[model samples]
Target chain A: MTDPDEAADRRLDANAAAGPLAELFTVDLTVAVATCAGCGNDAPLAAHLLYADAPALVVRCPNCAGVVLRYASSGSTLRLDLTGARLLTVTLAADGSVGISERQPHRPP
Target chain B: MSFVSRGFAGRRRKTPPGRLPPGQYDVGDGFPVLSAGPTPRTALASWDFQVQGQVDGVRRWSRTQFQGLPRESVSVDLHCVTSWSKFDTRWEGVSVDTLLADVVTAAEFAVAFSDGGYTTNLPLADLTGGQAWVVDTYDGQPLEPEHGGPARLLVPHLYFWKSAKWVRGLTLTLEDEPGFWETFGYHNYGDPWREQRYAGD
Candidate 1:
């Protein structure tokens, strides 16, 4: 027999999980943006230009002076068009700093 | 300390290693198994991870986001308080060290809540630079959901349950907050080597 108290506890848990993060967990977003690391163009770019391979990600164009928008994907890695931007790989250093390298391929955010 | 070769590159502790196995701490203590209380079956997509208390911004990530985070590969041995050991567990996901690295908030303790709503607390210092990973894979394959697939906190240095499974989120707190098991007379900081399982058992 199911305990009434256990049933009540389940109800309370159901209510608590109905928050914003609830909806956010199931949906995956995909975004596309442009690259402007070279020539320093300030115009908006398309997603096809900046793609890299890494687990699906929300890429941010670090070269963009301001306005960081999130481009989301679910793939194991991102695909980037390294046309103008110098594809530098950045990793969290042992000391916790951004370690940039040309050896490791640039991973889109 | 005498180390016994566990047939892997790493040596096992003969005197009961002071630290826990990686990828095992995410189950939130598994304390229910020892108690007379109810053990809840965690369902898919019904789990919630909370990042609250003393955090600059309160945030929550769902199963999708948990899976979407940068995936990492780590191999670890899991040592349980019950005296069974599973070695060479392969895990994939963000490390607890990486996940909490940027948070500016300071907390003496960190409490992890699991799907069954079970909880476990650990020291802030204990979470740094260990072979811990929020494991989503086991044995180089996608972890079966029953084994905390999608995501689970991995603290290899502590008891397996400290790695809470079906992990929803982390809550940053200044106080040393205790959760379900700790409140019910389990060890506050469960170290397998020390055999710290029950309260004054």
Candidate 2:
């Protein structure tokens, strides 16, 4: 299986923009399992949490009946090229590093 | 019962499309609240995206210019903070990494402002993780404005909101800013694995 990040990158490379949003909105499937964290004495969490504005869904652990709260990761940001948009400068360490220390509006050259 | 049995395999089962995962992620949160409505026909020809702030110059693109730009396709799971995992969502757009490939930026953090005025801020590392893209198509179809059509940001790793709909433009900054939901009490780094839905999340 492709790592999640790598898979997403490949998708971007292969298709400019496809049906990702619809898939997100499309109600696809449900895995019957412990809904609550306390109820199930499972080794690890089987269900993942995902939400948007408010609580999307919740289920109780039948045994312990603990509430399991799930929400989505708000991954949003801006990307730019040095010539097209504003530019930021910062020192990147030896490790594969990228960071912004300062910024100024970008001007088209 | 047999219908469900046939559809379900292992721990997974089929669900109705266009709706949340039935009992899961279904809170009657209502429409036009968290998501957008369908796109207008005129929107197709008139739609354009503006890229501003922390850049060399303000940039704007008509639907055509956007289409003319380099394109990419990616498939990844959308881990909503709401607790539903939709895997293998295929997206297409200009690779944010590619767009910013040669740009010189000094902003400390980047924020995405959407059409609904919804905003999500995060560190630059997340956006350039070699995966982010300015998504224009979803599943081989043009994105309807209701779904942030014309153009929307696709950050499969984070909650769908990070993938702002009706994404008019982008602004890079040096401060860690908060957005509409973030101000009300949403997590800064909404990681599904950590269950960070709200402040202190």
Candidate number of the best DockQ: 2
DockQ each: 0.01, 0.04
Compared with the true structure, what per-residue lDDT tens digits does model 2 show for residues B1-201? 336564334445454364343223522222233331112234567767665678776667788887898888888666565566565667788877766665567877778876534567877788896757899888899876556677788887666667776776668787888764465456787766566766775
Task: Give the alpha carbon lDDT tens digit for every residue of B39-112 in model 1.
Answer: 34555576545577777777665667766767778877676654556555667777777666667786777887
lDDT of 1 by residue, A1-109 (tens): 1766344222121112113222343311121123345434332222211212111111233344221222222223222223344332233447754332212322322
Candidate 2 chain A: worst 10 consecutive residues by lDDT?
A9-18
Candidate 1 wrongly placed segments (more than 4 Å): A1-109, B1-48
Can you write out model 2's per-residue Cα lDDT over A38-104, one digit (the tens) per residue? 4333311123222223332222222332333222323452111111112212334356342222212
DockQ score of the complex predicted as candidate 2: 0.04
